[model samples]
Target: MMTDSADEKPTETVAERGMWGNFRRWLGRGEDDLQDRLFALDDAIAHHPSTAINYVLRGECYLQIGYNQLAERDFEQALELGRSALARSAWGFGAQVAQDRAVRGLRIARRR
Candidate 1:
């Protein structure tokens, strides 16, 4: 019978503080150079291994640095993660977007 507003905010913010939080925070840090961005993304993935965007970003960093093979590996892994039930639960509504990003990355990676 307790209708307290104090308990409502946390239920809504769970996604924000989890996978979505890290991904959105990374995007909010605009104009960071590739190396710094890559390092941050690596750390993010180390903690949130199921987050698809981190994989995509790391793959992009590898691609930009002429490491096409590593880029391809990450891209492939991103796609796999995108399709997983665990990752999908974390993604919530962004699941399709994550898959789309991985597919696009793969296309670019395959051109080499």
Candidate 2:
């Protein structure tokens, strides 16, 4: 039988070099950091492509990450989706929120 030592470092896979350093850097980011939030929002948008709110959320994430062009595109898409939903009367308050968020995101993106 073989036993692993506690002092031994685990094998690296994600990155051969500076993996722990990278992890430490990632951990140093604040709770409100948008980099991690962006990934979750990306998956949400992927699964719910027609959801206007997801687009608005992702747009805000992009805005926080300083990706102005991407933020603008997402905001525009959210606005379009919200408008269509309202036109069909399919979404009431939800569509209004999406439109409002998209408008705010667009304004900030354009300003940057």
Candidate 3:
């Protein structure tokens, strides 16, 4: 048996590739397809609520779709789940619209 090494890339099975192959192709297609992928991601998040990256990714998708409220909510959740810098950046962007204190807090946080 071969030992796993740090420099070795993980090999993906054909089944695993097939599962997400369409999604990879659809990413560059159009907004509608992208939205479909986002919805699927949201469903995945529902099943795995503890995954912080999912919230961050879905927050970005919400921003792209002009769902500012949902984006803000997801970003806050991500922040609570330990994604401080990214969540602060998202909050700063949203603050441009609402002028929330999150922008100020983000600057203060970055100073330290």
Name the best candidate (by lDDT).
Answer: 2
TM-score of 1: 0.66
Error of 3 at 41 (Å): 1.4
> TM-scores of all models?
0.66, 0.68, 0.48
Residue 76 in candidate 1 has what lDDT?
A: 88
> Per-residue lDDT of 1-112 in model 3, one digit per residue for the tens?
2336877877543344453563464255467677776865666577657545556566666666667677677766665654444456745453333233333333333343
The top-ranked prediction according to TM-score is 2
Count backbone clashes in candidate 3. 0
lDDT of 2 by residue, 1-112 (tens): 2225777666432233343443343333455766665765675566568879878877877776799999999999999999988998854788999999999999999999
Query: 2 or 3, which is superior by TM-score?
Result: 2
Q: In candidate 2, which residue ranges exceed 4 Å CA deviation?
A: 1-33
lDDT value, candidate 1, whole model: 0.72
Higher-TM-score candidate of 1 and 2:
2
lDDT, candidates in the order shown: 0.72, 0.76, 0.54
